[model samples]
Target: MKEKQVLIVGLGLIGASLALAIKKEHPNTRIIGLDVQKESEAFALKRGMIDEIAESLDLAAPEADVILLCSPVEAVKKQLQIISRIPLKESVILSDAGSTKSEIVDLAETLGLENFIGGHPMAGSHKSGVTAGDERLFENAYYIFTPGKPKDQKRIKALQSLLAGTQAKFVVMSTEEHDKITGLLSHLPHVIAAGLVNQSKAFNKEHPGAGRLAAGGFRDITRIASSDPVMWTDILLSNKETLLGLLDNWRGEMDQVSEWIAAENREAIFQFFYEAKETRNQMPIHKEGVIPAFHDLFIDVPDVPGVIAEVTGIIGKANLSLINLKILETREDIFGILQLTFKRKEDLERAKECIEKETDYLWYEK
Candidate 1:
């Protein structure tokens, strides 16, 4: 039997991570990669994320048993068109890691690619590029597949077998269902976050202190706004119709809230927030979903020179890693709140135990 050859296009975070994950599980399987950015391709090759750099898609597609388009939605669509022109192996399973799937699935059907599957791995980092690739990036995350036809089940299973190394939970849904869910859970949130940031920017121009004052809560919610603007623009445009409807609904929601405030309807306002809090509190905290969960532990430490180092020293001594650390609220007179972020729940739990054992400081999980 021939050794499996997987071709990965776009050597960014998702692409590089996917390649690394595949290599980790199937060391003998040859991985070929192509990226528009020469540096990304070189980086992936040097880092052993890919076995070889493909000369072109046309040259690579015919040889690949599995082909994954890991680019932005628009780029994925263009690549689909390109791949449609190229002759692929009879058993080749084509898929993509685009966030939005409806348009891509429609395009695949239109292009006569019967074996193509629309995939979105619901996991990511704020960081991008090949340098940020990690083999465990998709571990325990949902990998949704939108197969265009009933007959594509065998091919979908084949693709899943190839990607089993990712350790992502597989989910199958219709393209329409996938789009509507993602538009609400992912794309719509990004749009709202960006809109909030822009509105704050306009306000900051009129009031200089406004931006600085918008720190903890505002920064937390708008963090996704800092994502790659070009990528978000492509995603928002690709799911324009769904987002348009969502935004219309969002406007109606805002109008209701505005009226509540205007009419001084205290009970209505309280019920609104009460329902939102109840719904939000019911969401699974530790599970990785469409949005990444932050396993954060907050420590209250003295506002002194060595306090941060002392806390970090404890975590480091235990051979634990922190995703990020920030001083949320600090003052000379009061204990400073230090935020420690972990990628996994186990790490967070272990870090908490270490902090408790090693320090006298008070810590809490939020």
Candidate 2:
């Protein structure tokens, strides 16, 4: 078979990771990269993420079997415009890793590009740039596709084959469906997190000690607020309609809670909390369908030397690797709460049991 050529425009985390994954799986495939930053191209080449740099879509798109736009949402739209003017291979398939799908998909359709599909990998890190890219970044994550035609199954399958190394679960849905769904899950959460952080900043400016007294839970909830402002700004503008509607829905939910509190309706408040707990607990703890889940164990342990090492040693001795382990909440006067995350349920269960049996600490599956 003739070696397939993949042209990745932009060498940011997602673009570089895709290139690395493809090269790892199919070393014979010709991987071409296009980026405005020459340094990114150099970095990707040195790390074997891409075979060569094309410099522009005009040179790359014509020879590419698959072209991936891994730029921010606004840039993805501009690239689509450029792709519309460029002469591409008849069989060339185009896609993107943009967060907003409706705009990109609509633009592709308007451009009369039959081979273009919109895709978003529902996974990312707070880290950015080529140096942060990892081949396993997309493993077990959901990869959503919004194709122009339902019968574009062959093209979808071809694209999937090219990205087989990602190990991502494929999901096909309409552009509108994707926007609404992601707006609720990803976009809205970012808005809320940023709002909370901004609220804290305003309060701290007046109170003067609030920021210094902030704890782990506050940082954890507002972690997403530290994301790149430029990238998030583009995403929010692109998905404005869906996000606004979601915000209104969230406001309604908050108003109901406020009313219950004002009325001193204990049963209503208890029922609300109980129902929310029940619903949240029913969510899958392992990667399934479009959701990427976590297996976490929360433990309360004393603050002392070797405490972390001792806890990790037990899991390590059991031959179980942790995805992430951290002291989520700690205070000088109170027992610290440690949270351990594992990629597998069996590993999580084993870690919980190991910690419970080895120490006099309290532990539970989170």
Candidate 3:
């Protein structure tokens, strides 16, 4: 095949990263990026994330072999409508990196864009924008495709080939399946995380010390609450029906737990927790899925100067890389807790061994 021209709209994190990954693997292929944010376009071009910056969809749509809509769900819907009116090439494969699929797929079908295929790359970070784009963001992640028609296998394969540079595991399913699964796994979690955060805020108003007492576990569980609210608001609204169903089921589960507690059934509560632990423990830890997992190690250290540097120095000397690190709590006289995050379990273990061998600090993994 001749060199492919890929046009990515919305040069945000996913769009810019896709451009970089494609360029890294297929240098001959041309990537054209377009975004409403002029700085994002300039940044992607200056960093060589894209070969060309499109002035408008009208001028770029015709030349693209593939067009990827990588904006927020609502923005993507508007782009699809605009692209529907644009005169695209006959062989152009249209797709998106949106979280939800059903609504987008329905819109495409309604617009008579038979070549449109729905895509959702199950990978992301808490960060946003072109600056945060990383070529390796989709590495080992699940890239799902939800094609609306049965006769689009050839187009699907071509689109897959175009995205092969991501090194993501590809899975195929229907739009319904994609929405329902993601609603339960991704959307519902965000709702619950935000709910928990709001609940904690209300509780903190009544008891000021409650917020300070929120430790590692609470922070970890509610981390998604820190995501871009506008983007998540669009996502939750787009998948409203699926989320409503999931929320109903979630409420029933909560009610059952409440009933168990009210009855003072010790065995029931014990079994509930035991079953939950077993199910959670059985989940795959190494694989990158819809939800990202953090491998964290907590260390107790004195609140003295160079104490943070000392622990990091030990890990660095062992050549172990940390994804992130922070001091969860520190006081003038009390020993502070330092949290170090690793990308893999092996690295976490190696860092722990290195720290123990070099220092007298007490450490535990979460």
The candidate that wins on lDDT is: 1
For each of the candidates, give the backbone clash count.
0, 0, 0
lDDT on C-alpha atoms for all candidate structures: 0.91, 0.85, 0.89
- lDDT per residue, candidate 3, 33-68, as tens digits? 999999999999999999889989989998999999
TM-score of each model, in listed order: 0.97, 0.87, 0.91
Tens-digit per-residue lDDT, 253-352, candidate 2? 9999999999999999999999999997897656533333457788898887788999989989999877677787677868998888775566788887
CA RMSD of all predictions: 1.2, 3.2, 2.5
| Candidate 1: C-alpha lDDT | 0.91
Worst 10 residues of 3 by lDDT: 285-294
Residue 354 error for model 2, in Å?
Answer: 8.7
Evaluate residue 181 in candidate 2 and report its C-alpha lDDT on the 0 to 100 scale.
88
Off by over 4 Å in 2: 288-302, 309-325, 328-335, 340-363
- True lDDT of residue 319, candidate 3: 91
Give the Å error, residue 184, model 1.
Answer: 0.6
